[model samples]
Target chain A: MPVPNRPDRLFRHARSEAIFIASFWLACTVYCCAYCYMYGYITPSRPLTERDVKPIWGVPSWVFWGVFVPWLVCGIVNVVFSAWFVADDDLGEERAAPIADPGGTEADVA
Target chain B: MRDIWRDVLSTGGTRAESAVIFAAEVGSEPKALVALVVFTIASLGLGVAANRFVGREAGFLKKYFLGNRSLGAFAVALTAAVMSGGTFLGFPAFVYAYGWITALWIGSYMVAPLTVLGVMGKRIGRMARRTGAITLPDLFRERFGSPTLGLITSVLVMFFLTCNLIPQFKAGGVIMKKVLPAAATDWATSPPSDDLDIKVDLDTGYMIGLTIFTATVTAYTAYGGFLAAVWTDVFQSVVMAIGVLILLPLSLWSAGGLAAATARGVHDAGIGYAFGPGAGRSFHPITLAVSFFFMWAITSMGQPSTLVRLMAFRDTRTLRYSMIYLTIYNFIIYVPLILIFIAARSVVPGLSKPDEAMPSLVIKLANPYVAGLIMAAPYGAVMSTVSGFLLIIASGLTRDVYQRFLRPHASEKEIALMGHVATVGVGLVVALVALRPPEFLQLIIIFSSAGMAAAFLVPALMGVYWRRATAAGAIAASLAGSGVVIALYALGMLPIEGTIAARLLPANPDIGPASSFRPYYLLGFDPCVWGLASSLVAGIAVSLFTKPPDEARLSLVFDDGPAVEPKFDPPKREVESRGSEEPEAPAEPSATERRNE
Candidate 1:
């Protein structure tokens, strides 16, 4: 009942993982870039003054929110997903074969 | 203190000019040089030990190139997330000049580990084991049964990887030059007297350093192989972390607390230091922010080096643990660098060269002994990166080109010999070229990294996931991707909007020309994005029009055949059959073969 010419369950796990990660990355990208450009970016016509940017724990408020906070959050997301959500597929054999002679060319036995 | 921002505005000079000026202040104390020497010796010992471990193992090519596919979680994470000298040297230079805007420039690294591993780790590992692939090109060639495709990949890998090494070599020389005796570097620091009969001043220190750096890296890489590269990467990763972590506190203390430093930095460089489109309009326009986000995450996913590490891990557990460790590693290294360098801006106000920022600040704040170890961080990174790249080039020539085509019946010893020879040969060539390095070494590094990502990312993704992918499609994808990026670089050499070539790619609009050569960021997006887009379009479109790949091959990769023994024991005939350069005959009674039976 399986669809023909599609990746098996093992490969599908990797594909799904890739899709999920990509979506998370897209979200982070949007938040960081949008926030930075909106608040941090300065121009002549729409200029920002020193008062407009405030220090938060030594970093500019814009950077604290736009980059630092998201970076911390993304790091957490990576940890959670990798530890819990990511799939664990059978990675096949541990060792191919032992070298019969340590002195000899190992590829000869392959 | 020199006001770098005001200089850029008034003199119409680029930040790069300031970089050249900083190269003059090169000499360091004896303790730092001694520390660098000790680090080098330890790395060399590790390399020899790795070689012995590899020699005692099975399958010289497999053990040497792929470490017999037995790396653990920590080794995988460190090697995969290995940072080049740019992370310490060139990147900090940008931060010193551009300020907090650089945070966004490198922001996407937060997800770099996830993207690099999550995208294709399991699938690529599965395919490599199933097909008995030792190298990246080997994976492609074996999967599609196309020697031509394999050969093209080999050439491209060699070309880009070789280009990638030049800057690293130069960085190694530059760092070594800094640690040389002041007497030797007198020419660099002081002008020759008019009373002298002949004003003969050459950078003797740099030459000596270049020779020493090149010999050390090449010898270890050629002597050992992949195992050496990975082990050294782990060691270097720890050293780099310690170096930066130590520098952070010292720098903050020197600048009188983080808040005061941040305030002073903004006051010194103007509000631009703490804002986007930073001082002198560098990293300008919103599109660039978007472009850099793609450049870091997506482009990194496509790197062959990352792919090679993915292929070598033990299992899913290794993958899972590596992702976890790398998240911690990334946060520890990258986040601190931004703050450390920002604090450094306040501590050392008028640095001649931004590229020299890390070393300059380290010496100024830390004592002679501590400064030496901090310097080791960057120097060790250079050695690890160079050695890693050398092995990749060696693998390309040895497995993909020589054994596969030139001498298919070569003995195991001959194959082993070729790997060593190729590594040394490539190392010497890159070192020789690096002696007279190009003006803009960092830009060249960026181009090569982007070029590799553009060339390999799409074809590789399609190859792993798409059962319908044909050899032609992959070949087209690679060529189109490489072509678009190369063409744009060539176009950038032209005078855009009737301006001179030198001014074409300024990082800051106010600065006349920062670099001699720059990539044409079309529509404010990097060439890598355009190249990647083209490759994806070409790969999918070409495959749709072409004949589907051989049904048997598709089943081998995509189907869930009757669970047989692990693909550990490949028969002798399959190994011999690689020499034929033909569509491989069924090596095992695999899914397709068994179904027919």
Candidate 2:
């Protein structure tokens, strides 16, 4: 029987998955740049308190929109990625190696 | 016994004199001291237990060095995630200094778990098993079929990790000193110079802390090896997590709230602390933010100690679990740190040194028991980091240097003896080097961590993924990256001055403003970025020029999933294991050094 080319599938999945996470990072970076450079009310150069008071989700506009919001998005993205990410594509081999670990031999804490 | 112990660690001044000076400097806080001592004793106890546990294992080298590759998900996550000094002390210190720009520095950390666990973890683990490799250099050597590569990589790792150890040692000393009650000299104000006989005593405090901390960690690590390190790391990580988790809410409450903290900052520092890079803002030229994000991610991914944790985990299941929990742990540690330290500025308004900000703020804000626990937090960080490095250095010495070069035919008993010796010896040398600490904790860390990542990043990744990654190419990349960093430190604008090497190198030529030409910082890039670029260029260019690594050679290690090889199997005839009876042909009988059963 011919061995299936599963590495190809695994590679594609891995690459796309990486891109999925990186897109979030790059998106945040772009948003930060726009928040600082494009916005009218806030500037990185001057003191931030000068801005007219605006709050989002119980945080000031300058912070809520710029920093903490992106972090919240990252947390959610990671949760989804962890719970449902594609991992360990089947190579269709009947007896693939069991990925053995020398687990209990040295330091098994009860 | 007390006098003997004091004399052994003495630095000219008497303990009584030092105590008096300490008294004058600050008030006493015994609760913090008691907390630190409890944590310290616990660390030493874990080390002792782990050493005994490892002694009975099948192979001394494999079991002691890699914990027999038996780590659970929780152990792996905690040990790897607790990047002691950097996360606990240096990170908070850096943020306290630069305000909201800390977010900019650590932004890429959002994707770090994804990048590290997803991108590198499985591949490195699979590779380690394929070659029966227990260390980073072993992987490089086996994959590339080059002893020269192994030797060079080992030397670079040891040298740079020693450089990395300095900041940790300094931070450990600083935290210890911070908690000690002020040295009440009882001398009058403006006493005469001879009559005063006074010293700043930070160095004295640092020396004492360094000796005790180093002694405890080094002893345990030398005894138990990687098992001891990981066991203690699990515990240390808990202490840090608990300490921080408890302190943040309490600190916010103590200082009123975020709004109140900002109000205080505006009143005193004349700028918004919570939302902006105030008057003393360090976020200039914008590129720094991007650079720091790259640094933490790259440095973390490439650190030898961190990579070892990846290889040592039980399986892919463990890797997945670690990824999830470490992400959550990082969120708990890092986000709260930014909030607490920003709030801390309200309490510690005139902190002259940025690094001292964490300890000072905790002392002021936290209740006695909580303050003590939090005070031990940074020490926990430093010890965990130090333990990891100590083990790696031992592995490098025993596996790469001693067995491969000096005694390829050495017995198991001999290698084990040497392994313990080298672990202790390396720890001692690092402690000595750390005695005279640098001015900025994070800057030196950047130079070392960044340089290390630049050197190993391409070689490590390409060697894993790229089938055509030649030994020559990997060599070129490692050389190009590390070589650039060293040259820059010697000739370019290094932070520390008054060196003999500085006198020898050509005086830095009068250059125009930073915009026109940044010689010291070439194109506004750190040595790390410069090194990374050079390595990429060199690795690619050299591989194209050189002969490709053999197809059979590539077939052994170049796989997407777990390698389909048994842990103790012999190399198939066509592929050829490098265990022949010569240096050039580099092979030997697998005696007691097989991976643990």
Candidate 3:
């Protein structure tokens, strides 16, 4: 059996990370969309009043809970994942310089 | 995000007509002009400084086009996040039209940084380094060893990018025309102190504004290349953040508070505005909600402009840091924007042109000079996006076209010069097009964005991650993706009367029969979902049936062994050779690497 190498490992790492992040995204979408659609989508026939529209910190209840709270949590999750969870693998060296004579420019190409 | 301007107004007219009419009414603001001029001058200065930085680098082509893959975290995050003119103009207009529901409409954007960077960043960055690829098409061509794929990718990128640029140039001109002094033009009649009474012919003003907009943006982009664009984007992002932060408190204060604003907004536009499905049933059912999430996250990964940023970051550390920065930045800009525009419903009520909400509220809330600075947020958006597009188009022309096919033996200096010329040439063409621009500005933006994403996303994802993906598969995927999007749009424009198709998918009456350029939302989901699905299927089926990619090429691009780190200070002779010839080939693979391949 061939030994798994850097490319294979990196691919596996990227795939696993992608799946995790996508799952988090799915969770946020379900909670926020379902919550807003259920609570926020009221019938127009019913008259709306200042009292009837429940608000927290000046934002509507659906917006506060569905959008803002999930948004805040997503931000926290993103920070944690980006800072700690996401690996810092070596990106590899840039391509070698050309084969030629001695004195020239092009110092910091990469 | 599917079509931000499709239903921008609850009334009947389009975004273009509303803009023209609004410009006719609101005369010029002198202080705003001064503020804009100051910002433009500063941007020009940055371009000059960036040119100096590029001049010192070795490979002018790589440095000019990809910043020598040296972008830091802040530059990467800001340039990636500060998308385009729509973020400020179309989005606020969207919020104005559809109350608080705009929150959920744009909510999926929260995952944008993660989705775009985390998934593709490391893979693309590594691939580019290994293949010595500077542009998106370069990566594809190098990986597959197929110049045909390169040419096709180039054509698609250039075509879609130009489509994207025309509307942005038009937007910049419209904003400037909105502020043109009534008495400045010969065909103007100045009224009393009341600005509402003032009326002027906007033809001359529009031309002047477009000319200035074209000159400033084109000059900076052509002069300094990629570094200039990225640095300017960083500067513009700061300006955008400041603009939003300043507007937040003032808008809230003007509307009494968020509570007061929400209450009044409900009173004015109805409770439907504050909730889902919107007042006009805009976000109906559930498919659209899911489609929008896909639009922002999945499609963003496909954009050449955003993908290029991934290839240029200095290290994985930069990528990680940028993700955090982008998350914070999105929250600061978007959440505040949702609050401010919600408040605008109460403060600047009964706006005929909903797209004018941002400027209208700014003028009403802040002083003239301050309003100009705040207006810079949108103007900066236009400039930053235009500059980025110019770089991509120019790189596609010079690197992907001229050097690759026409002049494969061309010298480094010749290619560098061509790069600058191409940037200017594309800008000139786009500016001329903007002079007699199509009526539907927003639709063009929508098409270009979706088309680019559709054409490139699946092929790109497979190329980087899937070992079995073939050149034929990528080509098939690209053609299928672009074809599907165009066909849907074409079918949407046709008069499908008395046909099964007509019954199945009818025209959106709001946009009218002849004028409706929107795609038929199959099952209420955006056309992009269909396009992507088609692309993915074609890529997989074609790859499975056709021969797999060449093993040698695959090994070259995806060798699994530990990379031989290049010495920062190469032997003097090697440095001299770099100037004279092509880069030296990478070291031969180890035994373990070959076994894995």
User: Number of the top candidate by DockQ?
Assistant: 1
TM-score, structure 3 vs. true:
0.86
Give the docking tier of candidate 1: acceptable
Q: Which is the winner by TM-score between candidate 2 and candidate 3?
A: 3
lDDT per prediction?
A: 0.72, 0.61, 0.72
lDDT of 3 by residue, B1-597 (tens): 213333433222222323333433344667666766776888898888888875464577788888888999999898878544456555777677778877887898788889988888888998888766789997887666566788899999998888878867776776676576655544744222211111222367667778888899999888988988898788868886887899899888888888877767667666667676665455444567777787787888999988898889999999999999999999999999999998898889888656788878888988777776766655666777788889999999887778665776566778778988999999999988877766555565666677888899998988988889988899999889878887776666566788887777755433211124666677667778888999999989998898766444565557664333222123234322111222233333332334458
- The digit string of per-residue lDDT tens for model 1 on B1-597 reads 123322321211222222222223334657767877887897788789888876464777888888878889999888777664456665677678778888888898899889888788898888877766788887887666566887898899888887778766765766676677767666655443211111112356666677888888888888878888888889878877888888888887888876776667678778777787876555545777787788878888888888898889889889999998988998999899989988888888776556668778877887778776766665677788888889989999888778766776578899889989998898888878876655444444556777888888988999898888888899999999989898777766555655564465453232212443555767667788899999999988998999766554555566665222222212333322212223323223333233447
Candidate 2 ranges with C-alpha deviation above 4 Å: A1-25, A33-49, A52-58, A89-110, B1-28, B52-57, B166-211, B270-278, B348-354, B432-444, B488-519, B560-597
Model 1 collision count? 0
What are the clashing pairs of model 3? A6-B560, A7-B560, A101-B573, A102-B573, A106-B58
lDDT of 3: 0.72
TM-score, ranked from best to worst: 3, 1, 2
CA displacement after TM-score superposition, residue B5 of candidate 3 (Å): 6.9
Task: List TM-scores for all candidates, in order.
Answer: 0.85, 0.78, 0.86
Mark the regions of model 3 whose C-alpha exceeds 4 Å error after superposition.
A1-9, A43-52, A97-110, B1-26, B176-203, B503-515, B562-597
lDDT of 2 by residue, B1-597 (tens): 222211211111111222222222223467766776787788788878877765463566777888877788888777767445346555665456555545545666666676666667766776676566778887787777676787899999988877666655554554455555446222223222221122223355556656776777788788777888898778867877887888788768877776666556546555534444323443333444445445555556777777888778877677777777777787788778877876776767767555566667766766767766765655565676777887888889888777766776566788888988998887778767666544332334445666788788889877877777888999999999878876775456444368886566565433211211123555555567677878888888898898777444454465433223322122333323322211122132221223222
